[model samples]
Target: MWFQNANSPIMEYLLFFHDVTFLLILIIAIAVFFFFELIFMPTDPHRFLIDNQSIEFIWTLTPCIVLLMLAIPSLQLLYLTDEAHGVLKSFKAIGHQWYWSYEWGQELIFDAYMTSIPYRLLDVDNRIKAEMAIPMSVYVSSTDVLHCWTIPVLGVKVDAVPGRLNQIFFSLNRPGIFFGQCSEICGSNHSFMPISLESMV
Candidate 1:
């Protein structure tokens, strides 16, 4: 319930997977508790005296099936997040010690610093603007220490390593402003390095 509303296809898939896995876990826990109660009843003194091979086999196979169900979809989502083909727009996000800089091509570049005005720490001096319904690629790197660029609503997070470049792909489904912060602890002002993105049609 605390999760932010999903604004992209990947985020929707992530939310669906989370709900399905949670339901599976709840069902397994309840079933296990029920079996424990039935097996350990005080009135059934001979409960441990009998064993059924069929029941043993069913329990063993059930867990393996459950594991497969969880694994297959998880692997698919992982692959989906990494696929960056046919990206219409590409940009670079360079993280600094306490701020973020963006390059939208050779012609446009700017630094986004934290502001204390309307949105308080969540607001920035400049926001990244882009169109919706277009596949976009973002290359992330760090200029100083380690940092992470993240946007939860879009389900995009990539580490900004000092010497290496990491990339993430996503398409926004709606027009709105999304906020995220540096997930990695880099310095004393780590919390002040906020990320703001404004999506449009």
Candidate 2:
């Protein structure tokens, strides 16, 4: 397979950034390997090894320019991810030892637990629907110990710390089922707590 699938717009941007950075690192690694080979060559005269100001300047300035280019998009994505300007609905998630409970306002609330058998998707007492391109704010907290509320496809990972509330905002780009799991080590049944989001158009 090419890579893990991306569902949301934020995930798409993240995947793009990952690919760009990976290519840049690969190029730098190959160039460094070639430089080392030339340095350790036995028949090398080393005549061009002298300090050249132009070459030094170009090398230094090139990295700065490349970093600036990356920084622009990097910062933009960061702000976009953090922005919850148009959020219409708010949800709350409470993490427990081996299960997760979600509350949507005061109208709906349910607990999610792991299934006994292997399946394509996770099991939840209630499956929340999120509209496409509509921002939603999710507040996460923990009832005991520490847990994490995460959704990989939406690029959301918030720690559920006791007495501390962490919030994250996300919007889905299309209708699909997305899955995640507790990213933190909370307890023995940490592997059982799976998160699933059903995005609807």
Candidate 3:
């Protein structure tokens, strides 16, 4: 619920910065594209009010600036992966066709967790926790076709490509269960590739 609970003092600042640097740029870009595509778009109208060359230059430079804003912090975040670690614990999440495999690693204890989604997932009975039991710091990936392991609350998303190990390191800042899914298109049961996390204190 990190996206939903941006009401605190510290998180509000982080959310503001996140929006200024990411969401705003995306909104602006999409609005510009929509404007070009749908709105005030005269019948074969000329761009830049004059020449095609000017319109081309404007579009080119605008995206360059927007993407530069996007990439600068994006690369910074990727390069400095562990700077935000609350503690030193780690977990591993491995992706299969219809479910996710979780490996929880502690200095003293390690447990393997396996779980799947519940029926009527949209209208569940208990919203307090997840149907699966994935522990924190569970590094997750795929075993076959390409998929993506994403936990938005943890601010972590990585591709689950086959034959390759992609890792994400996150400890549970909060003690509860988290849920995610296979964010990439793979096969017939791709939508069933759900992920879960149970944060232990």
Candidate 4:
């Protein structure tokens, strides 16, 4: 469950960035622990513990450099992933107490309720295609309380607030079944309200 299988370009980039940051953090942590070990049990009695300007500079500058390395790519990904420059499909998702209602750009609207049993793939795709186009742009909002629309593999999540529209843009890497759920706790049946996306070619 902890492992992530990325399904889109945004998700792939996010996973790569996470690994890079984790590696950098691990290296820094190990180096700092080693330095502390040396200080705590120094073999030389004359080893200076207080007045090390060079060591201080190195620690400070190293963190700044690391931050820069992480920040630059993060900012780039933020802009690149956020704006749907060439979005062809559009949708609106509204959150209710325990279910989700979706409206397509073509004016088709419906409510989706979760179930343990899976629907036929062809039927699901046909229904979705009757409403939306590929590479969708989704707008989110809540009808009652706050909710979070999240699809982990797709690398898309946005808040659904009352009277407020939050948007996310994503393209399906391939045609398949993707699942998600309301990330926010809105009501008693929140767990039952799952999301299913059937992307068509």
Candidate 5:
């Protein structure tokens, strides 16, 4: 079935191995956790016992084997995905207190500020044309305080730390204006720091 599927060799290996590894580790964890008892028993009944080290071996050995299986292929994939693979462009995004600055280069960059609008408000807002779709690459870092750049659907979120440059890489596989926010609390404007990305193509 894997060979029949049309995808790259590395992608195929990863897809198959990831599941196999997860199942193996999960089974190992279940075996260890259930070994001492059907589920988990406590050294002391007083503790609610949400966590236990009963399956230490299962957890340890399985992860090691999974990593070993993954490492060689992962490294190979990383090497193959290098710059020489294709012509990919880079963008830089800087995070301010309540807005995001995107830079393609010195000549081309834009500042996207979060506007407070109700669900129905989008219907009237012509400026909100990208309410769901604008093709762009977002790179985020901070100007001062710490902030978290999150977009759940794309599975790309990272923190913007001050003084140090923190970067998160993502492309809009889905073209739409996605919602995000500053997860970390910073100053009086923390609650006001709403984030939204307008995906376009």
Candidate 6:
């Protein structure tokens, strides 16, 4: 699959960008193929065209313009994804050997262990629950080794390094159960350490 279903505003933006980029790539590929066919064909019309300064200038300038077009929105989305403002709640996720421990404020704390039932490795005993459409932040850190807390639908990924906390901010757009796993290669049973989130309205 190219991407999981987008359930957050940031993921929507990312999908839009991906579509535009794919369209641009398709158009460029076709144009290049057409040009190659025209050049190699036995009965070519522009056979005498050895050097065309205008064509060269156009190809160069067109790529520059296309790059600028991609870069502007790319930078804008980068800023938007990195921006964490007006966060209503915050949670701390600590990565252990093969499980995730979440702390909500100082009172509520729980460990999300991979469960065999339900969704198998994708399910967990305890899920991180939060309200939908409300901006929330998560501080991720590791206790033993490196790990990555990633939720594809939410377009949130943060590295969990020992002694260092990496934060990610996102808001769920819909109410459902979203699943993820530790992306980094931590150790044995890395694939078993799954993350699940329950977004509520």
Q: How well does model 2 score by local distance difference test?
A: 0.84
What are the lDDT scores of the predictions, listed in order? 0.94, 0.84, 0.56, 0.77, 0.55, 0.93
TM-score of 2: 0.89
User: Residue by residue across 45-121, what tens digits does model 1's lDDT show?
Assistant: 54554697777888799999999999999999999999986899999999999999999999999999999988988
Strongest candidate by lDDT:
1
lDDT of 4 by residue, 115-141 (tens): 545553211221233122356788999
Q: What's the ranking of the predictions by TM-score, best on top?
A: 6, 1, 2, 4, 3, 5
lDDT by residue for model 6 (108-188), tens: 999999999899889999999999999999999999999999999999988999999888899999999999999999998
lDDT of 6 at 182: 97
lDDT of 2 by residue, 58-145 (tens): 8899899989978999999999888877888889999999888999888788898776444533656555677878888999999999
State the weakest 10-residue window (summed lDDT) of model 2.
116-125
Determine the C-alpha RMSD for candidate 4 after optimal superposition of all C-alphas. 3.6
Give the lDDT of residue 161 in candidate 4: 99
- Candidate 1, run of 10 with poorest lDDT: 45-54
Model 1 scores a C-alpha lDDT of 0.94
Clashes of each: 0, 0, 10, 0, 7, 0
| Model 4, TM vs. native | 0.86
Off by over 4 Å in 2: 42-45, 117-121
Superior candidate under lDDT, 3 versus 5:
3
Model 1 misplaced stretches (Cα beyond 4 Å): 45-49
State TM-scores per candidate.
0.95, 0.89, 0.54, 0.86, 0.53, 0.96
Show pairs that collide, candidate 6.
Answer: none
Cα misplacement distance, residue 6 of candidate 5 (Å): 20
